[model samples]
Structures are given as structure tokens and as C-alpha cells.
Target: MTNSPAGHTPNVVLITGTSSGIGLHAAIAAAQAGHTVVATMRNLEGTRALLDAADAAGVTLDIRRLDVTEAQSVTEVVAGIVGRYGRLDAVVNNAGSGHLGTIENETIDQVRAVMEVNFFGVVGVTRAALPHLRTSHGRLITVTSVGGVIGQPFNEAYCAAKFAVEGFMESLAPVVRSAGVSVTVVEPGAVATSFVANVGFDPTAPAAVGDPYAAGLAAYLARAGSSFASAQTAESAGSVVAALLDGDVPPFRVQTSDAARQFVGVKLADLDGSAVQRLTSGWIA
Candidate 1:
């Protein structure tokens, strides 16, 4: 184990959703920073990219299968980690799913599916790790999106799930702090990843050929595409999570990039909700 600046022993970090995107990057970054990383995902079949990236970075990770949406999977993984490592110093809940559609267009089942992955998945992992975290004075970090703070057009279901996560963490932060565990929510703006393509919906696809919400959806997709063109890289965002895990006094909330900070700042600065309403209204108008 390595020693932190404060001389604390290196963390035994567990990060979920390591199959790709931010989770993959965070797992690599944490391992490079000297933490014992246990990177997990729902399936290990498509982990070649992650393995290749880690190899290029000269860091090795103990990869495991942990489906955060399943309570038994979460319990078994956490228990196994603790039994082997003797302590779990930190857990980064990076597993998430995305949905893109207005409330009028999406089925309730579709929204619930997003919640199952984004909200309940985080809850399962946190609950399973809580006892160990309390014992080790560990940290709980989650990779939320700017949508968590502001409702974006065509992202009703996705934002709702993220909003629920932010609320749950904000409320649980203080309670867990008393038990020596730090809770933090890291929000990122448009990240350049396969996330949009993997979300199981393509607004720009020809499938939306004659949908009622096509025009509005197309416009929103164009705007989002423009934003993603200049978005932060997954590796950059991952470094933020790594830094938080290494910090002795991490903040309760953080934005991975300046753009993210500015985006979230708008809603935070709106005391009357007028600014957000005006902006969101334009998206679907």
C-alpha cells in the first residue's frame, strides 16, 4: 500500500461500471495513483478495451463482475472484497444508464428502467459498502451528470433518475459523515464517450422518421451534439474522481470541468426558477 500526503495508507478502491467510459478511466486513474483498484462491471465479456487501456497505462486492476442493479450481486462483491483486502477504503458508484425522450413520448416502463440502473444501482452499491466504509472512514463518490442539477430537454427520465440520486446522497451525506464516511457527488457536463450511442436510443436515427416529437427531438439532438463536440474527455473526468479519493477533505459536491461548473451554476444561481424554465421551454418549443 502507498501512503497519502497525510500518511494514511493507500485506499482499497472499488469502482463500478468499469466496462467503459468514465468508470473505465477512473479505474485506470485510481490504480495509477497507487490505490488497490477492484474495478467491476455487470459483465466481463466486453472488457478488452478496458484491459487494453489499463495495460497502456501500466496499471493492473483486480476486475470483478458486480451488477449494481442486483442486490445479491452487490452484497457478494462487497463481502468478497472486504474478505480479501481486509478493508474497503473507498467506493465510486459510476454505473449508470441513460434515457432520451420527453415525458409524453416515453413509456413508464422506460423511465423505470432508467431509474433501476441509475438510482437503485447506486443505492445497492452504497448500502452494501456502508458498513465497511464506516469502519474505514471511507469515501463514497458518485458520477452524476449536470442533468442531475438541471432538467434537460429530451432527458426527462434520465434527469429524474439522476435528481433522485443527488437527493438521496445529499440527505445521506450528513448522516454518513457522523459515522466517518464522506459522501460526494461529482457532476459532469457533456462527456465525449459512447454513452449516447449506448443509451439504446438514437434521436438522429431514421427510426424517428415520422414521430410526432421528431422536429423537437431533432432540434434537441442537434444542440446536444454541438455541446458534445466540445465536451470534456472521459479521462479528464476520471482524474477528478481519482483526486477526490486521494483528498483528505473532499467536498460534498464537485463538477468535473469548468463547463460543467458553469452549467450547474446556472440552476444553482436561479432563486426563482425563471432562468431554468425559460431555457428548458425553448428546447421543446
Candidate 2:
């Protein structure tokens, strides 16, 4: 589908996991930018608060239920949007979870849980939405983490999942370019979201490690919490999304927070050596 000027706006946008955090903010920000918004979540009822916030801001959103892990649900939601909107301008794969754990101490299920929601879920949603996006030559954006590029201590599973997301999106970008579809992955540093507070901690919550490691865990938790507290807000992330959407050409990777940008530079600089061993040496056995 060729781009049409609907009141001078470029396209309609559909975002997943819009109940809170960057997903919620991005939906509202895009709507404010005059793009039609489809703000979807696992449960529409859980997004009543978001609906109220949008109402207060006088921005309208087409809220729907979208469980990205379920193929049927993804297909239904994308079909509904395309049927109603005639074209899709962009789709943001923003639904994901965080995990903090040592690999040995963490259960297989714990790691699988993160992958299901963060990697496979995104793959399902993006695949389902590709047809509509192809029709419009739209953009596919995913909100990944800095861990995706650089692994961190005690975040083995989370880092793995983000790495998978980055790889998947990166590989998909070239294939879709011929269809005029663009893919951009946003790598954010710790952000002030309920995610950290709700992060699954190695299947044992805060009490996962026994005695000596438990003390280290506590210290790590303190630093992690502080880092997230001092990190960028959801509004700032939304602004970054808005900027990417408005850009003439989409970037393959967009780092939002200053911390993420710095970390990216450090990570890129270490590409030639044993960076993985250097970063994970102290933590991993």
C-alpha cells in the first residue's frame, strides 16, 4: 500500500504491552503526533488505568487484547487492526519480562519463561503483523535492553533473551528491506519501570542465593535498584520512539539512555578481544 496523507500524518501505529511503561507512553506519544494508535495488551481490562490516562490527555486509542505468546491471539489482533485501519504504519514489539539470576541457581523454567515472553512472543507477534506491515511498507520496532548487546552479571537469562531479540530483528531487517519494511531495535539502559521491582529473581526471588552469595545478591540488588531509579523515564523513551518513527531513514539500533549509549561504546570497543570472558569472568564459574 502506498503512503496516504490522512490529514497529513504518515501512518497508523500498533503497539503491544501498552498497559504500562514505555509501551503505554509510546502509544500516547504517537497518538499525540497525529498517528492513529492501536494500544494492545495481554488483557484490555488491565489497561483501564492507561485508558483513563489517555482520556485525561484527550488522546484516543484503539485498545485491544493481544497476548503475544499466543499465535491465535496475535493473528486475531493484527487482522482486526488491518481490517479496520486499511493499513499499518508501524508495530512495536514491547511486551517483555526481566529476570535476574545465576544460571546454575536458576531453574530451566525460569529461563524459559523469559524467552517465551521476550523472544518467542515477539517473534509470534511480528510474524503475524508482517503481512499488514508489508502492505504499507511499515516499520517494526522492538524495545530491547542494553543487556541484549552486552551481557551482565546475574542477568544470564534476561541477557540471553535480549540477545535473541536483537539477532532476530537484525536478521529480519535485511529480508524486509526489499519490501520497504524497516526494523529498528531500541536498546535502553535501566529505566524507571515497575519491571525491576517485579523482576523474577532466579526462582527464589531475593532469597535465591544461600549465605555468601546471598550477601552479594543483596549488594547487586541495591545497585540494580539504584541504577533503575536514576535511569530515564518512560516519557523519555516515548520521545525516542517518536523520533525514530519520524526519521527519514530508520536506524538498525537506537540507544535511548545516556548510560546505554556509553555502554554501547564500551561494548563496541571490546569487540576484538575476549570481551565476554572479561565481562563475565567474576560472576560465572
lDDT (Cα, tens digit) per residue for candidate 2, span 1-285 = 122233445478889988988888888888887788899999777887788779977999999998888889998888888899777788888998877877677689988988999999999988888887777777888999889988887787889999999999999999998887888999988788777766844434556335446665666666666676688998788778766666575679999988889877777788574765565444433
- Those runs of model 2 whose alpha carbons end farther than 4 Å from true positions after fitting are 1-10, 202-212, 272-285
lDDT of candidate 1 over 1-285, digit per residue (tens): 222224566679999998888999999999999999999999899699899999999999999999988889999999999999898989999999777877776689988899999999999999999999888888899999999999988888899999999999999999998988889999999899888778788554574546788887777877878888998999999888888887466888999999989889989999999999998778666
Error of 2 at 97 (Å): 0.8
TM-scores, one per candidate: 0.94, 0.90
Root-mean-square deviation of every model: 2.2, 2.9
* Each model's lDDT: 0.88, 0.81
Highest TM-score: which candidate? 1
Estimate the lDDT of model 2: 0.81
Candidate 1 structure lDDT: 0.88
- What shift in Å separates residue 67 of candidate 2 from its native position after superposition? 0.6
